[model samples]
Target: MTFDKNSFSLAGKVALITGGARGIGQFYSIALSKYGADIFVVSASQKGWEDTTQKVEANGQKVAFLQQDITNPDAADDIVAAAVAEFGHLDILINNAGVQLRNDVLDFKDEDWRSVIDVNLNGLYYLSHAAAKVMAKQQHGKIINIGSMQSYRAGKRIFPYTASKHAVMGLTKAYADALAPYHIQVNGLAPGYISTEMTKPLQEDPVRGPEIAAHIPSGDWGQPEQLMGPMVFLASEASDYVTGVMLPVDGGYLLR
Candidate 1:
């Protein structure tokens, strides 16, 4: 019944972001920390997280790191355990870790197909399943899955990535429904053409860059920082009534 801006703050919240060492995931880590959340970063690569950790700590937020291949079946439980041990509880889980390998469906290798699905879809389920248990018991939490524009549109090639994203939406909805009783809100953020390490090559393509930009109403590539607001909203009480929905922070690309 009362309004408080601090209700939007993540103070005392603990968040775990997979693939938090780089790209969009790295931005998620720092942005949440800036809003007063302590951060736990889980990733297969640790090379880039040292800088991310420094930024979070610089913001006066406690941060922790775990190096593990989230595709591994056991990695999810381990991540949740480490986070709970470090912070005593978790209030947010960002399933931002994903892999995209471009290949025509006809030529897509078996391993590429499996690997993309493993990291993007299977790993998400594993991690979400683990975190939901802890959160369900507590009856309060947020699970934000990093979906993609591919979830709604299929571009050329990248069949596996498209398939995985589409599947992610279903998982988001199912979890949202099942966890609603426990007060654990689940949602997805679908980013379109964000300028990040994984997307740099595509954006750099002499032909592709301008072509893609022309379609986006914003007429530019979006930065990771642009996504911070939506991330914080869904993680905070602002979106307590929003769930099982894929909010596209796409500069209107999907409309075109």
Candidate 2:
């Protein structure tokens, strides 16, 4: 059988992306939609997705949005149920919702610590477990977790965020090991200092900005759109054999 890798297309697949309204999630949603997947977006807020919905629709794809906070444990089941109800099945899941709170380690509040971990790590567990149940029964699925460069390095002021990302990679590997038997591929994408709304403040700082740029081997910040190709590869048949790997989309920052 001569294989033409053009089978990499995500056509007819259904993808559910958490935090799909903005930042990297928005980019992932649109990228997948353009690759022929129907997108079901799960977001904490509906206020910002009008443009996202339109963009998906313009790509000749169907899209639905759920405005529910993922921090709610039950939100995971609700979001997956809604997506499966609308699309019949979930072929892909992107756990891309996260937040960061920078504080001096000595001054970090208990609430702040708990909140960051709850959303970044716990929410992913809630959602991934929900999706995995469905995927396992169906015997096929793809999970692409959005990790961070912080997963590898410890910065001065963001302890909780760093801890949460490291936990995310751990969760990715464990899930991949457990789900691989069901043919579900679970993987992580660790982005380094991307130029997004979340990183705008850091990028704009005269001191922090130059310091970060210098640390990256490419000497610049990465763009959210730059992840589209790798996202598609992982979500499609091209990555059928790939699992539990943290693919860094950094500008060679890890090499520094």
Candidate 3:
């Protein structure tokens, strides 16, 4: 086969990104759109999506916003259906919606634990399953799950978040194994500590912040835009032969 550089192009494709209203999810939405894919975003609220929509539109791609909590039992099907309805087809699914609560294990409430698992693991599975059905029919697709540094190592005061991310890696591999025959690529992007609203606490901490950065070989936290290249590669034809793997976009955090 000819090695056309345009193999990275997402022209004529549609992508569904969960938790896409802000933070890392927002970057993923805009980056994918910049490469030629129309975007469908699902978030708990639509309040702050205007900028995301504008960014995608500025890329000359259409964007659709959906206000739905992934934790809702029926939301998976509804989300997939809505994306298909908007663009008439779905080509990529990014399971970027996740939640985390930090508390000492002894003081962690059961409700908080369940909430983390619901959004991070259970909800992701439902959405991936629903999207896989659609992709299977087309016999080609990509499912990119957003994992975390916690996906590989344990972190203090975030037990549930740690557990849920670990499960995400497992699901990525399982889905890849089962869906490969249908030409669907199931993989994950495990981001290291990135500067975002969600990690503001860590960034603000005088001691913890420096300690975290010191451990990273890069000696700095990652920026959201740094993830664009990896995201596009996994979501486009460039990764046709890749599946069942977790690609770390960390600033060499894992190396240490």
Predicted model with the maximum TM-score = 3
C-alpha TM-scores of all predictions: 0.97, 0.97, 0.98
Candidate 3: misplaced stretches above 4 Å? none
- Order of models, best TM-score first: 3, 1, 2
Worst lDDT 10-window in candidate 3? 1-10
**Candidate 3 on 1-256: residue-level lDDT in tens?**
4558899999999999998878889899989999999999999998669999888999999999999999887999999999999999999999999888889878989999999999999999999999999999999999999998999998789999999999999999999999999999999999988998878988889998998999899698999999999999999898999999999988888888
Per-candidate count of clashing residue pairs (backbone under 3 Å): 0, 0, 0
* Local accuracy by lDDT, each model: 0.91, 0.91, 0.94
lDDT of candidate 2 at residue 39, scale 0 to 100: 95
Instruction: Name the best candidate (by lDDT).
Output: 3
Ranking under lDDT, best-scoring first?
3, 1, 2
RMSD (CA, Å), each prediction: 1.1, 1.3, 0.9
Q: Which wins on TM-score, candidate 1 or candidate 3?
A: 3
RMSD to native, candidate 3: 0.9
Note the residue pairs that clash in candidate 2. Answer: none
Give model 1 RMSD, 1 decimal.
1.1
RMSD in Å for model 2:
1.3
